[model samples]
Target: MKSESKSQHVGKVTHHELKQTLGTWQLWGIAVGLVISGEYFGWSYGWASAGTLGFVITAVFIAAMYTTFIFSFTELTTSIPHAGGPFAYARHAFGPTGGYLAGAATLVEFVFAPPAIALAIGAYLHVQFPGLEPKHAAMGAYLVFMALNIVGVQIAAAFELCVTLLAIFELLVFMGVVSPGFQWSNFTKGGWSGADTFSMGSFHGMFAAIPFAIWFFLAIEGVAMAAEEAKNPKRSIPIAYVAGILTLVVLAIGVMVFAGAAGDWTKLSNINDPLPQAMKFIVGEHSGWMHMLVWLGLFGLVASFHGIILGYSRQIFALARAGYLPEWLSKVHPRFKTPHRAIIAGGVVGIAAIYSDELIQFGGQTLTANIVTMSVFGAIVMYIISMLSLFKLRRSDPNMERPFRAPLFPFFPAFALVAAVICLATMVYFNFLVAIVFAIFLALGYVYFLLTRHQRETAPTDALLEE
Candidate 1:
């Protein structure tokens, strides 16, 4: 933990491993999951009765808005796709304070998401095996993933490759059932009755759905966190970014269309594992045993959780090395060559979330879910800021080397910025209260940085000042 000379890599930044371990395919597997449609569980806001058009509008808006945001991230990530992701980018573009807020939000978001995914795994497992206790299922899944992450990235990547394949297979199987039983009338009429309409009673309900829908599409940028591990970052990073989004877009459309046509879309509303339930109705238990579908879906959950923990730990490592947080957190296990401190820290947060769910009577699931939602909004805010940073950096350092340039330059980034703003505007529309929560989170991070200014003396921060 000793400080290095300013001329040295004081951030404890070391290219300690070969980049060949991560290629375009591995990176995409780690970032995108075929079953992330679980995110849309709560998407049924009071708009469904507005008919098929409303569903399509929500679906297309999410897809387009998210793609634009990912494009903006592609530029930042390719430039400095080191471990910290946004934390690193914000530091370079806007200095320490900006870095701290973005890093803090990213850390909280990552830490919370892993357990949430674990819980999701439990939900699916319970649906699949009615005898399994929900809490036990959750803890068992968490324990399994905890080990998977600690075993080292090589093992994690291999596990990712396997589960990703399973995910794709399961998606195709579900698609097969849905395609043949497809009833276009189910989608065209009465499919959206349960959602909130634009009326006064359900205005907030409708507003809340925007952030939830947007949340499903926000984490694709996480693939860039592995830039330091990518075989050829300049080529692999952009491919991973764009490719991940494309995969998600196709999967999302498939799920939405099938879900709409196969069942009363109203029933699918607000349920976490709507696909399996919909599948049961579409193909009946005989086509695929209900047990098999449920377990397969749980496997997808585990795959996503594993990837999430890996991506998030690197963000923590980047923040630690840059001196915004404790230096020990920057350390990598010498043998495993992974961010050990960040991994453990992420585990603790995951455990805390489990306890919070157990101890709170005020609907911990709902609250935790909302907190995660707020985290998603926090990401949107940072994205909007980051997109602006892209324009500013291009103007300020036009001469800087960019190994992978964003296509169409300012136009694409500008379009992304506008989409990000629309996301924020939607957040404000849906729940000003959640917007306030994100604002408070940002303010607290800034204040904590002020209180921690003394730690800067011996802390490594060269990365913050890097060109």
Candidate 2:
């Protein structure tokens, strides 16, 4: 048909054209970089719902979910190795519709995650400098990081590696400084709420803490989105993915346990920087330890903030290149060899998301909480579709080359899928407002794609597989 021919006008670029500059360390940088901020804040929100013990219970469950999911997901990322990530896998297995939904979920995940970190960055600075306001500092962070992303990716990735290293160092230092102040009594004083034993409130609180637990490792999946630019994706991705998750699990457990022990657990809950606040217990507020954490801790935020910018940019570029979004968004900068347009687009949306709720309040929910839950909602959907894609591909394309196979096969992904579904359901029930907002965002995106679907001119990035 003429329509099909017209749509075919959209073109695809060869892999050699995209520029493969990232190596194992850079890949590791991006993987952990996109998630290290989770160690800084947001996890403490769990304490507001479920005290220390209940929060730990929820954290343990979610950690298991991430550990299993990452193993199975590595299989898809290695075999397909496309920038679209879940979108590519779903499209290869299902079709355009499946790819569109997966990309949208990815968009939701990467797009909203950075702004929450931006706010935290602002909060950290505000604590140090009384004159600077949190909102202004947050918007300023967006400006600075967005420009750095536009200048170059190698620069960005190198910076990501440095900050990631710095963040790891900061955590190590935090543990050492706080260990002397850590007492078993602080952890158990209000360990269980409502009853000395277990209460229904704490039970409900544990599930309510799911989103916060998810925060500790939220954007780790974003490592796959940079596949097009990785020098040797097959070798680098699996190592980065596995190493990143294991590091986060240890840091999450350490920071939570030590932080609770350092101070009144309840006081540390829902704050911008629990570690810095907890440090005040030993080193006075005016001490060098407090000053060091406040300054270096910015690296943790920058690592995630800068790295997730890389993620959402790639997601935008991938979506645009595949016809899920506008074509211009996919074009790489000639000078920088990075998706500058996509980076700018993501920054614009993120800044708007930062201020949007301010103009219209919703149930006293902070913008940070709403965005985090909504991102998790998208993550949950992506997990389900991606796992389904894994199974579907196994059945549909039995001969495909997979460099790294999941250890337990179907069992790992199946357990991850179940856990993802439960987390999704819990978010919808407890955080209905954000869930509805996320649904509305998805509907609007789908409707736009529906209107433009027939006119889009794009071919599958891996069309040779079928040919």
By TM-score, the best candidate is: 2
What overall lDDT, based on C-alpha atoms, would model 2 receive against the true structure? 0.85
lDDT of 1 by residue, 1-467 (tens): 12312334445644423234777888888767522534334444323423444546655776777787777678788877577888767666676666776787777667766666666666666766899976677777767776776667777887887887787677767777777778887766543333333344343343445665665565667776777788788888888778888887887677677767886666666566677777877668666455566667665677677887787888877776766677788787777778877778877777666667533224333644755566577677777767776886788768766777777777777887887787679767655665666677678877777777555554554542465
Which candidate has the top score in lDDT? Answer: 2
Off by over 4 Å in 2: 1-17, 458-467
Model 1 CA deviation exceeding 4 Å by range: 1-20, 34-52, 128-132, 191-207, 286-289, 358-365, 461-465
Residue 317 lDDT (model 1): 79
Clashing pairs in 1: 45-195, 45-196, 46-195, 46-196, 47-195, 47-196, 48-192, 49-192, 207-430
TM-scores for the candidates: 0.88, 0.95
Across 1-467, the per-residue lDDT of candidate 2 in tens digits comes to 21331345446553323568899999998988899998988899888888888888999999999999999999999998888899889877877678778999999999988888898888878877979988789999999998898888788899999999999999999999999999988887777652346777788989988999999999899999888889999899999999989988998999999999997888888687789889999797999988898899989999999999999998898878766788778888888888888999999998888888764247578778777777889999999999999999999988999998987988999999999999999988998887888888889988997878743545334442232
